[model samples]
Target: MLIGEVARRSGVSARMLRHYDSLGLVRPTGRTVGGYREYSAEDMRRILCVEGLRSLGLSLRQIGRALEDPACTPSALVGDLIRWAEDRLEREQELLERLRTVDASAPSGWQGVLRIVELMHGLNSPSAARRQQAVLAPAEDVRVPTELLAGAVLAESDPNVAGALRWALARAGSDAVASVVSGAYSENVDIRRRAVLAIAEMSGDEATAVLADALRDSDPTVRRHAALASGTRGVTAAVPTLVGMVVEGTNDVEAAEVLGRLSLDPECADRIMAALVDELAAHSADSAVRIRLTQALVEMSGTIAQGVLGQLAHDGDRAVALIASASLRPVRVVGLPDDESCDDAGRRHPSQVLRR
Candidate 1:
């Protein structure tokens, strides 16, 4: 067949066919009287093969090697092709996400677009300081989108940068809750942990609802963070986890403080006191645990917790007895810098006395 006929039938442009011939990928098998290139049946098959491989994202050199090298096997080359294709796909997906974030911002003009682009670049920067600055940068005119801040919060690993991102998300308020909540359910433990932490800083019923769900997370860290945040928001469901933290000595002081605050509600007070008493009974053999619980009781109203403190004051453990007895006393001031009375009674904050 003539090159023109082959081009017409095969859909390969004549220019491309000539280029393929020069590369020896598919040379014409013969020539006509006018010296035009002529393709044989075998040449047509070779042209089809090159196009087939090209469709699989093969480079021209790779196609030539694949067609000409007898020792080159399809298995290894196809595997390499698969990896390259995957890399390209990942790049495209990342680009798509960036575009979506920018579009979601609804930039007013090219200047707005450039500002967002710069912010995104900073957020994705390798340097943690740059990422932090990206989040903390002044944006009086151009408000950073909540989605962008939430995304950065979930992905940030550095402690300082992660905190800054969470702060930014908090400032974004409930608008960022959904994005951060999605991260709360992420398969990655770190991502889930970050998600809960970010959501914990957010306010509003929506954030509180997300935290309530997060309390059931399998990861203990996620649950602890959720419990703390939820408890502060008056979600009574956090009471159990907060009590457990006291027992486990994981942020026990803060947990106890939250529990004490929760106890302000008369009904919640009964439940809080009951949970604390139960923990005290459960850990009767552990002096350190009992001591911590004793300190936690001080946060409760003196009227409700006085009876329990009286009984604990006479407990077998000397340290528990001293702490409880001190708690029972009506010191002129508690938790004050110049309250020498607390020092005179050898009383200290639970956090100061317990390492665990």
Candidate 2:
């Protein structure tokens, strides 16, 4: 196949194919006398496997070994990468401490070494002014240092460092975007959650989709954080999926809160159907959750309010009624759409269903 055909089949750019060839990770089995590279089907499969391992964060050297040795476990490679990441984080901490120790104005015998360390730190620090210049500068001049900064910042102990790195990366655009996700799929939940939030904030479509996947995270708090971040991004594409999770998933009050928040939007109300309201109203669940759901409804009063409240009131469970009653107590603010929540705040506004 030609490079374009290979690029289309493998989703690896033509330029990247050339890069793989230079690295000897994937090379054409034969070359024309004029030196144009042609790929056989076997070569294309090899390139795809390389792409997959790369997606898993294997270094080309590391992936080469795994590909060459079928017994090698990719999981072991992941562990090695994680340790490598931790080592970098520790180095970042040490460097930050060393920088803090070196008083800029101090006179010292080790001034030269201190200055060198300071220079390395300076190279690490990216300023907003420098980043803006990269945006306007010609591509030849745009050495935005994206991978350097992203690697340095995988776990910066300071927001100042991370924020500066993020700005510098904005100069590099979507290419810089993948670094956030590279960290997200790691075994670390905290790492994944933070990466997911950072990516969602960057307004990247790939990041938005990946963050939604993180909502199924084992760490409820991470899932909650990821869910809220995705919802806040207004990626309504995730609304239907979130709606099902809210309606059926148990012990996921935070997910429910985010779902309720998203569905409160006029167009999303229908997705927050009676099943979801009942699930939220189910007193068996956490009270904190019921409160959040009621609060969400109060914030989005309309037909949703009337329908949810009326259902709660007519149900045999007076428990929901009590929650609704509490919601109505302040009727000053939207109350929990508990059963009796509306008895006091009742259909006074006339039951309104948000038109689809």
Candidate 3:
């Protein structure tokens, strides 16, 4: 077909055709005698492959091998990619586990969720963290509606159910898990806890206030989960609330876990340090709080995480002990890029970037 005809049929710009030509991706069979470009059926198939790879979350460079393999099946490709995901999740879980042991302030439910993420990290190929990374990177926009996520959660079952909801929520938002979170909040304490789990798994600031309201819930599990959810989404406002609970509130295991995630904030570094100082001044204080505080310091250091072991070389805490004992420790930081923010900046202009 002629370039103009191909452009019209493909809904791809002529300029993009030239760019693809330059990439030597969809090269012509031979030039016309008049020197105009001509595309064959084979070239069209290659273009279709490019489009398919783009939709499959593969970068053009990364898609080269797959595009070249005519026998490549999406199912097989996805399965291979799943193995890579499995390894990453396993490693991330181990790191999270080490962080948890040292972390005393974190809520039990928060730990439980992290553990779950640890167990099921490879359940989905594109995780919430990975999806957020893709969302924030230089690529075409892919929006999944919240309603779609909610419905999918109900239609699916365990193993796949949780991961699918998380994947959708990462691209969508809390509204995605609205049905599950809403349904759980009204049930028994355990049910409410599961709801909070759903919210945390697929969470952000969208339901921060709603989760915050749960902080005062009669159920400790609900309150604990709210604390953990706020931390995952970086709801700093809940810091003071969590601190109050840790200082004078219940000595619950769940509360402690939330405190651990809570105290992880670098912004609250000074506050946590001062808390430790205050405890040191009172010689009769409980070792339990002190243990959590040390875990908090090590965790905070890990979170800030650049040359942490070197900087904390002199800290006398056992949690800081990880710093002294190092053998190529791997540190992973996951989040959205600066440009592709989900809060409000992700909103698209009406029909912008639409193909005719």
Candidate 4:
């Protein structure tokens, strides 16, 4: 078959077929009387093979070798081709993500577009300092898109950079809340922790709700952070976890302080006092646990806790009794209504005299 016929039948352009000939990938097996190149049946098979390898993303040089080199095995060449295609796909995917992020920002001009591009590059920089600077630099003047910051914050590993990114995300406000919440459900433990941390800094009921949901996370650290943040936000759902933190002595001080704040309301005060007292009773056999619980009671406000403290003062555990007695002294419940009083009457005199 002549080159034109082969081009017509194979869909490989004549010029490309001639180029293949020049590269020795598919040489014409014969020539006509007019010196026109003619391809034999074997040449047609070779042409088909070249097109087949090219379809697999092989370079022209690679295709030439696959067709000509006896040592270049098909398995090895195909394996390299697969890797090369994967690398290209990965790079293209990254580019697509960048474009999508830029599009999401809806930049006002080329300058705005350039700013986002630079910010993205900085966030992904291998240098931790560069990532840190990228997160911090936006504070001065650059306005990074909240979505970008939300994504970066989840993936950030450096403590300083992660903190700065969370600050930036917080400053971005509720606009990034969806992204942060999405991260809260991520399979990655670190991402979930970061998501809760980011949400903790954010205000609004949505952020609070996200933290509330995170309180049940399988990861203890995630649950602990979420519980503390939620308690600070006055989510009543955090009560159980906050109470547990006191018993476990993990961030027990902050947990107690947050519980105290949550107890400012009359209703919450009674519930919190009950929780602490219950935990105190449950851990009665463990002196160290009892001591932490006894100290945690100091964070609670209102006379409801004073009665519990009074009873605890005479407990079987000497350390518990000493700590509770000390806690009972000079104690005043700040938010109790005048009508409200401790459940035990005998303890009332100490509460009354203490209230005075």
* C-alpha TM-score for every candidate: 0.88, 0.43, 0.34, 0.86
- Compare candidates 2 and 4 on lDDT and give the better one: 4
Please give me the total number of clashing residue pairs in predicted model 1.
0
Candidate 1's residue-wise lDDT over 1-356, tens digit each? 99889999789999999999888889999998999998999999988988899999998999998877898899988999999999999999999988987898788888788888999999989999999998888874776788888878888889999999888888875577887788988899999999989888887888888899998999999999999999988889999999889888999999989988888898999999999999899999998889889988988874779999999889999999898888766544444554343455677544443211
> What CA root-mean-square deviation does each model show from the true structure?
5.7, 20.3, 26.9, 6.7
For lDDT, candidate 2 versus 3, the one ahead is 2
> Across residues 1-356, which tens digit of lDDT does each residue of candidate 4 receive?
99999999889999999998888888899999999999998888888888888898887898886767899998998889888889999999999999998887777788778888888999999999999987776433445678889889998889899999988888885587886788999999999999999889998989988899998899999999999999998888898898898888899989989998998988988888888777767876888888888877877888777877788889898988887888776545445555554535625544344443
Q: Model 1 segments beyond 4 Å from truth?
A: 333-356
Q: Write the per-residue lDDT of candidate 2 for residues 1-356, one digit (tens) a residue.
A: 88888899889999999998998889998876777889998998899899887886778898888888878887777788799889889999977755543443232446544443443455444563443333333333223344544554466545655565555555556766675678777787666655664665666677677877777777665565566668767656555445444444443455556555666576666655554565575745575455545444543446767667655555454655665555544333233343333346554344533210
**lDDT for position 179 in model 4:** 68
lDDT, candidate 2, at 200: 55
Candidate 3 Cα lDDT to native: 0.55
Alpha carbon lDDT of each predicted model = 0.87, 0.61, 0.55, 0.84
| Candidate no. 1 TM-score | 0.88
Model 4 misplacement above 4 A: 71-75, 139-142, 314-322, 331-356
Clashing pairs in 1: none
